[model samples]
Target: MRWNRIKRRNVLETGYDCLNGIPLISLRYAIIVAEVLNFHHAANVLGTTQSSVSTRIKGLENALGVLLFERRHRGVRLTEIGRHFVAEVSASIAQIDHAVRTAGAAIDGMEGHLSIGLHSPITAGFLADLRRQYRASYPMIKQSVLESRSSETIALVRGGQLDLAFVVGTVNASDCHSRLLWREPIVAALPLDHPLAKREAITWLDLAGETFLVQHGGTGPQVFERVIRRISERERVPRVHRCDVARDTLMGLVAAGDGITLTTETTTHVPFPGVVFRLIADESESARFSAVWSPHNRNPALLNMLDLATQMSGAASFMETSNT
Candidate 1:
């Protein structure tokens, strides 16, 4: 009669106090028993003895102050109250289990999100290969990429807007951790009829008096600075036309014979109808790409990506040495 009165009270009325002394194991046992309707079968499925299962269910009923099952000669059947209790308990237990699994996956870097900023095209080269391998290895990680100027990419990493950034040249931020992952040789994108295009490779000096078309985004500014640094020593100022455009559009300008632009080896993978790519003869001219991230940021997905990049960088270096 007392339990009947208590049970009549709304389940939420007791709030946290009601379930304070209840063990999750007892709740689980009740769910199993309700499913199988036989104490022995439920115990078997739970890998426990029938008596243990029965005791747990009894404890759960006492804790809830309500009868959950009616014992019969054949097995057991749920009472009207038992059915409602079990249904609610089943859904709650499922949600708890899912929450536990999702938390664990996030901690282990198996499921999470990663945002990366890039200054170079990922159409081909080490960064491209690394992206493919990372995706295959951690399929659950939601990855998003944004292409911007090298300075902007590094700024995003420092400002915590980006999880990681692949940028040209070294990053000198005190708040960020940076590692040079790879280097790409500088190349010139010239029009088909450009006199220098006939050569297998051309030195930066050959680019003298030629108008250089560089974009205002991505690696454009860096490329412009590099051109000045390389050709400034010859007492000749490089004629550079900085245009606000994308890399592809800059390449299109080169094809239209507007002006030649500079790029890295990776961009050569894609063909532009009237554009030709030639390596800058100066071997010292290269773009050192680095990965930059905030030291204070502890995104597990970002850690996993850095680890993979380190491994791939080592392997790439080994392969290059072996080839030589």
Candidate 2:
């Protein structure tokens, strides 16, 4: 999508200028200039040079064919055209400020809906408590949760389809905002009476020839693939039996001695007959889970959800610490 072709009807209009043959500067810069009321200050605020600000203003004026400022001994003053422009700019700024304050208030007020997209591993334990508490605290606010792969969750959040998500593994996104929630090392899962299950901690080399079970898609598979690739250095990639199932089901399969799997220590709950989780001896490859969202979201409920997620992460940390 070309940014130059982007236009809005009732709010903004930018297209090929038939008169001055120059494109319009965005309202963002206009708001900055109006606030400072000085080219240098506006430039400084906008992280540009004074000359650049003057050039942009000139370009903007030429594009509209309207003089927006009157120079004086003290400083530049708004001309008739400038006065009219300032009013519109000021009104827009006021509306924006009002919207921001109102949004903040709504987040604090605990109103509106929050849509959450998260990978399956996170949804199993502490996150459930967070949903329960958040609902109890704010009965008025509506919440919807979607379980998906980390990549898909991040994409949805970035695209504005989801308000927030818990993502694992590396995030290649540059546009969306992210916060580190917690870091937990991936542990090796083995069935009861399994040879390696007796060990306190195991390494990739320890399971060199063992059959491995890995989640099918998203960060789970990616992480497993990385470990396998590294381990395949002196030997073939160990026989990996991939499974498409929820976290609990995966654990059940491991308990049933289907195959060993790697997952976060916090995700080591064994609801099935026999299962044991052993920490990985390697610390460098430890996985970190992050809470991510788009900064452009104006919804207050989403902000509250972020805070709630943080709290849940904290609780999970305490639980893990106690377990260890």
Candidate 3:
């Protein structure tokens, strides 16, 4: 069974010759004849001879075993059955046309779906804005954002569970590639009434002996690790408490004067009522965000997203250089 044929050549085989050697053009001819109600006029509109159009319509009528036209003195007119046939065929042709367009767009990366993973909670700034811009530009493409821990995000990307991911720092995976997207300065998240909350900036030592609350995973724990790493190897480390709860819960504990926590400047965008974020005096303790993805992924939409990120990064660099 042949699906497509041109010049006596079978281009594709679908194991079903449903059309029975009939050209799809015959359907178009039938539709035009029904619209014009005149054989000569329909031929003129189709850029074919009148006899050709009439023959095509006759073939279609014979195939369907129905009388499609009722001859009249003025011109040809559609029979009651022909009108219903035309309506159904017209709807089917429109659907076929839409499917063709959608397939073409998918090949060009302008359509389809993408799943992206997020590790850090940068839901309010550049990352969020970038995703919004992507949606605005390609509304046909469906997107989902999966929130998870840093290591889990990287693992998902590497395992092909996610098309892309935005995670903290850099991920070291042979099967995955990562590029830094942006950075945020580490800030001390303290209770509004804490002593350091009044200062413009505070050092890591300022947090010493302060109940240091940490998230089990994510920005809060990353900050805790860095603070402890910065302390001298011989010096006794300050006591730290762990909070297996969410970031917002940890912030609430800080506000309750239960403990203090640290996060990047992005946390300020999140509305934590009793939490005040202050810059860390040591700038080296800043946080870096990166995008990680499986290098083997063949999704064209993923490629388009990566291209967009590159362009935006370049534009940001240019603006920063100009400002200086």
Candidate 4:
């Protein structure tokens, strides 16, 4: 990140007699001083002598006509005004870093950083493999993976906040490109002691009287609720227990005999004891995974991540077919 000090000062110099023998200096010097908060460290980072940094900072305060930092016995601390100035300056620095990286990528015929917005299920599976391989091949390109709900992720991609996203369900943003990754069928997870655990497959009606555990995230609970309503036609939907807050937590809860939960086949390798996964007998329900990217951002790093996702999906499909 690059730190930018305000180019134009807001200080109005009303009197030439206001100087109390303090010297003047640049905003760049003030920025370096604010960042390190220590005269020595700031001097080291700026490749200057500590005494020089101190002298320059004193000069900056003289010019600004306000104390930016409170000089402590050891190091320093920002005054309230200094804190606000630092916040804005730090953000500007980040933007400057991005601008520099973008320019460098252009010269080198590549793209800079790639930020991926992913839903919980996609983050757990397809994206995991993609991240590993993509980083290995393109170590120079930085990657950011954010996990959020499908709706929110889609909105981010549409607004240009995210470079790309892996989402569940359909992505309707016209400003971005989306590719189908896989279709996952929902399944029921039952405790080993449950009678339905022994069945080859269980239908929605089999859960009519059972206590259902709903995994909360994305639209998993909503989709499952719709499935339950269709099969169990009650005036009030069953108050299903919500046990797990995250994907892994939900799996742990399912294995602990909390209650039966619904999930996809892609999720496996549960560690807890006495848990059995049963395929849903019904075929009417399914969820689709997709890769969404902004059409405007031609970032090669983002495109490379998408390529990795495509490769992972292909490998998964081949594995499925071979197993079948």
Candidate 5:
């Protein structure tokens, strides 16, 4: 029996039957065959001979001890197991490609200092992988994070002091160019013992008698403002309470039964002893997160970061990069 080795993104593949068995080509061939349903057509798509595809597939089936496809006169039909297997293999290929891009970009890229500002740790959690990938791709480019209020982060971007900022809501600045990355539903944080915590979803009116806590100078105020605007009749709006402390402290208040607060889905990751995060019944209470930067700021590393972000986000801004 002949053997082969394929290396991609640190994932090593050896021969059809080795210490670590399974060939990359076998998985690729299986997916193509499942998609085309004809060995000859799949071979054309894979840029290989029909017999070669057949041989690899037979080896794959033998290794797995199951028939992936039923042979037919003109074509083939995938087994129930084959359909699920192909879907998983396709996802694996996507991750491999991401790893390749992350590795390749870090190698041949510009080196510079980058200052990033963020309002919440949730934003950091979402970009954690991207940041690691960026660091790997631009090892020499020093990067640091400055956790501050959204207002300050926006100002820093306007002043060109910060290269990138992940902010909540839309940014209104002539010098700053912003792109919406995602919209997450603003959920209400209530004490585990609170009456409303028992409900699956809470409404605006449900909060009429509740004390609404807003994080002073942070994105929490803007989210609250929108919640107020969403209410048509303001006959009895909840009295807003301002918290000058940090997010964790404010959540501590909720847990202490001092008051209830509203925040984004990212806060769910934050575990407080007595706080429960519940989704808002109204979809209009969604919070928008955006990436903001000064157009005039000329940083090669920042440009590279934006390109990767654009590709990852799949936003219309991606078109702008293509044009440039």
Candidate 6:
């Protein structure tokens, strides 16, 4: 009768529209009652009074305009329509619960997506170790990496295209928050039989006049500038060749004795046949790497990653101090 009254006032409304008006609490009560087949038992499980549970079920049945349960002297049983309704509602409630849990995990930085931009090779070193630890700690968070030039990575961070960027030098962008994570000593990549390869370490003077090969992308320009600054001061002005190629390809050319190139200590971990790596003994030969991100970006996963990096950087500094 109540349904008839509501239906009369809204003649064009669909059945789904009417169902939408029913409160979730009443639907849940109906589901519980159907599960236990007794109002008193369902009330006990729900931590409520039997009369309250019975009233909610009665209201839910009236809203549907059908008897959902057949009451007996001892308990109750579901009608055919009631069985179908309960099954559907149970599945929907399960989905709602899952959604709530997923949202909460994302908020807590335990699950979500993280996009990182970097110019450095993560084959070995702090960045590589950091990635491994982050994946272990937040296995549910999806990670993507973009390797580009330092300038491009910084631009991506400011535009909100990347959650974080690690680059080879201190970032001084007003729109970005930056932190110096670590410095890697510069190393020279040389053909194994080259005269300088036998040295434990080499100096800028040692490389002065040697033909230097650098790639056009990634840290190539930076290496070229450093080579010029360090070698040109003596007025010996080295012969530098800029090649359009990948880092690995440049290393191959170095192996073939095309020329020598500069790299950070982390890259020395990867072995190139016919090539050897030697550290530059000059104090200024190390490259300082910094992490950059936009201050306005509020991705929880990004925050978590930054926190982890800070911890790892601090630990590494402490270890270095102890060793010295």
Task: Give lDDT tens digits, candidate 4, residues 167-286.
Answer: 676555556677777667777777778888889888767776666776566756565666567545633356477654766666566667777777666664444466778887775767
lDDT of 5 by residue, 89-133 (tens): 777667767667655555545555789998776434456656777
lDDT string, candidate 2, 1-324, tens digits = 111222222233333432235443445455566656787777776667888778767777777788887655654667787777767766654665556655666767566788888764443555666678888988878888888877788889888999888777445466777766666767777898799988999877887787787877755666577667757863766678777876778878888888887777666753456888888776466566666777677787777766776676764442221111
Of 1 and 3, the candidate ahead on lDDT is: 1
Question: Tens digits of per-residue lDDT for model 6 on 103-192?
Answer: 889999999999999867788999999999999999999999998887888899989999999988776666788887888888999999
Model 4, CA-based lDDT: 0.66
What lDDT score is found at residue 250 in candidate 4?
62
Best by TM-score: 6
TM-score of 6: 0.86
- For all candidates in order, the CA lDDT equals 0.81, 0.68, 0.74, 0.66, 0.76, 0.82
Selected candidate, larger TM-score, 1 vs 4: 1
lDDT of 1 by residue, 1-324 (tens): 112222222332232433578865676667778878999998887778999888888888888899999999888999999999988877765565567678889999999999999967788999999989999999999999998877787888888999999877776666777887887888899999989889999877888778989887777768888878777877798888989987778888899999998888998998888999998887485677788888878899999998899888873452211111
**Model 1 weakest lDDT span, ten residues long:** 1-10
Ranking by TM-score: 6, 3, 1, 5, 2, 4
Best by lDDT: 6
The residue-level lDDT of candidate 1 at 167 comes to: 79
Local lDDT at 229 for model 2 = 79
Better-scoring candidate (TM-score), 2 or 6: 6
Which candidate order results from sorting by lDDT in descending order? Answer: 6, 1, 5, 3, 2, 4
Predicted candidate 3 versus true structure: per-residue lDDT over 1-324, tens digit per residue: 111211122211222333567567777667777778898887887778989987877877888999989867767988889888888877766666567767889999899999999865646767877788888877888998888777787788878999999877766666677776677787878998988888988776676667678777766566667757765432657667877787777888989999887787766888888889888776574577777888788898998887787676653442211111
User: Whole-model lDDT for model 6 versus the true structure?
Assistant: 0.82
TM-score of each: 0.82, 0.55, 0.85, 0.52, 0.60, 0.86
Error of 2 at 70 (Å): 65
Candidate 5 minimal-lDDT segment of 10 residues: 1-10
* True-structure RMSD for candidate 5: 16.4
